[model samples]
Target: MIVADGLEKTFWHRPNAKGVLGSFRALFSGVGSAKKAVESVSFAIEEGEFVGYLGPNGAGKSTTIKMLVGILHPSAGSVEVAGMSPQLQRREVAKKIGVVFGQRTQLWWDLPVRDSFEILQAMYQVDEKQYALAMERYDDLLELGSFINTPVRKLSLGQRMRADLAAALLHDPAILFLDEPTIGLDVVAKERIRGFLKEINRVERKTILLTTHDMDDIAELCQRIIVINHGKLVMDGSLSALREQIGLPTTCTVQFASTPQIQQIRGIERIETNGMQVQVFYDKRTISTPVILDEISKWGDPLDITLAEPEIEELIRRIY
Candidate 1:
């Protein structure tokens, strides 16, 4: 459903001084410096696939998304969505994709949320029957009926985001480009958006290309992850496969009845402890979870145990 072949975006940033006068002078003077935000990054996403495009701040994730969505033209290579070039056939491609940018809303600020939906329906030239069904389906899925009459400017961040999601799907686009749809949202709000996304992808067979800093979002929604770093494609694989490829240690935290001395174990890399709790970082690829659990049990009477994947930052660092 989506393809990017050697896609690249190069931006020329002007040298600006600290204050207003210096910035004004520099704009008319020396040559600007060229920075490649996204360079030769390419990947193909299949129909009905949920893939995470993950990267750190200034990692060119947004640059790549913009090119794919036709918001920004690429400096090199090409991007196609639904077999149409987004840059060349932007209008035609727009009908095949839905986009949600978290910090920015496509809804009219002063108008009621219902009005924005109506406007988009007309712009898309949607049939009245299709419009009604879309509204009904999203109202049920997003629980947007409560604030449908409220002006978009009056809605909270969570409500505005939910409204944005509803607005994006009004035309029933086949692909979804979700750029941090859960940013600044509480856990409940995030979960609600995630559930809606999961349903749309599963029931409607929508292809999704997601870019987010949140690891929980990736874990819950995406089956495949395409990792990018420093304007280059670094890693791309299923979540489990990525873990195995990176070989990051699984963290096991155990609350013990007493501080227990942990001896060297084959798979266990390191161990740290507080008063009654022990934290161990171990490579599960080398040894089984059962083996590690058994060794921990032998240390002391365990009260509680929680196993977690390495932090996403740590995982990204492994690729670098």
Candidate 2:
């Protein structure tokens, strides 16, 4: 559904200066350095595939998305969204894609939510039957009826998000670009959006590219991930493939009734002791939990046990 080859974007930054005249001079001279925000990035996404595009700040993720949506033209290489260049045929591409940014809303703030949908219906030239059908389906799936008449600016963050999602999908685009869609949302709100996204991708077969800082979002919603760092693609594969490649280090925190002698185990590594608890790091690929628990039982009576996987940030740091 999407293809990018050697895609790149560069920006010329204004020069820094001490005084007002110096600033004016710098601006006129265009003396600032040129920076490559996105460099030679290449990837292909198939229809109905949910891929997570992940990276830290200044990692070219937004740049790539903008290029894909025709908000910004690439400095080099080519991009084809559903077989047409977004730069050359933006209107056509826009008709095939829906974009949502967490920090921005496409809806008119002063308009009632219902009015916004009506406006979109005219803008997209949606027929009456299709518009009614879209509203019916969205009301059923997104619960839009609860605040359909409320002004968009008056809705809660979660409600606003749902309304925006509904607005984006009103045209029934073939692809969806969600940039930090779940950021700053409560757990319940996050889950609601996640469930909606999963259903849309599964039943509607919409190709989704989700960019998020929350690892849980990626883990739960995306089947595959494309990790980028320093303007380069570091990893791209199935979630399971990444876990296997990274060893999915599982940390077991076992609290005993008393501190036990720290002993070497066959499959555990990086074993450490802290007061009443013993922390053991082991690769799930090499050790089963039952065996590890059995070894712990041999040393002392356990008070509590918990296991955790490495955080997404730690995983990215490891890759870069």
* Candidate with maximal lDDT: 1
Error of 1 at 249 (Å): 1.7
* Model 1 RMSD in angstroms: 3.1
How does candidate 1 fare on TM-score?
Answer: 0.88
- lDDT, candidate 2, 144-226, per-residue tens: 89899999889999999999899999998999999999978899999999999999999999999999989889889989999
- Cα lDDT tens digits for candidate 1, 1-320: 99999999999899768888888888888668999999998899999999999988899988898999999999999998999999899999999999999989999999999999999999999999999999999999999999999999999899999999999999999999999999999998999999999999999999999999898899899999998989999889998888888888898999988877677788678988888888889898788888999998998889999999877667766776
- At residue 152, candidate 2 shows an lDDT of 88
Over all chains combined, what TM-score does candidate 2 have? 0.88
lDDT of 1 at 202: 96
TM-scores vs. true structure, each candidate: 0.88, 0.88
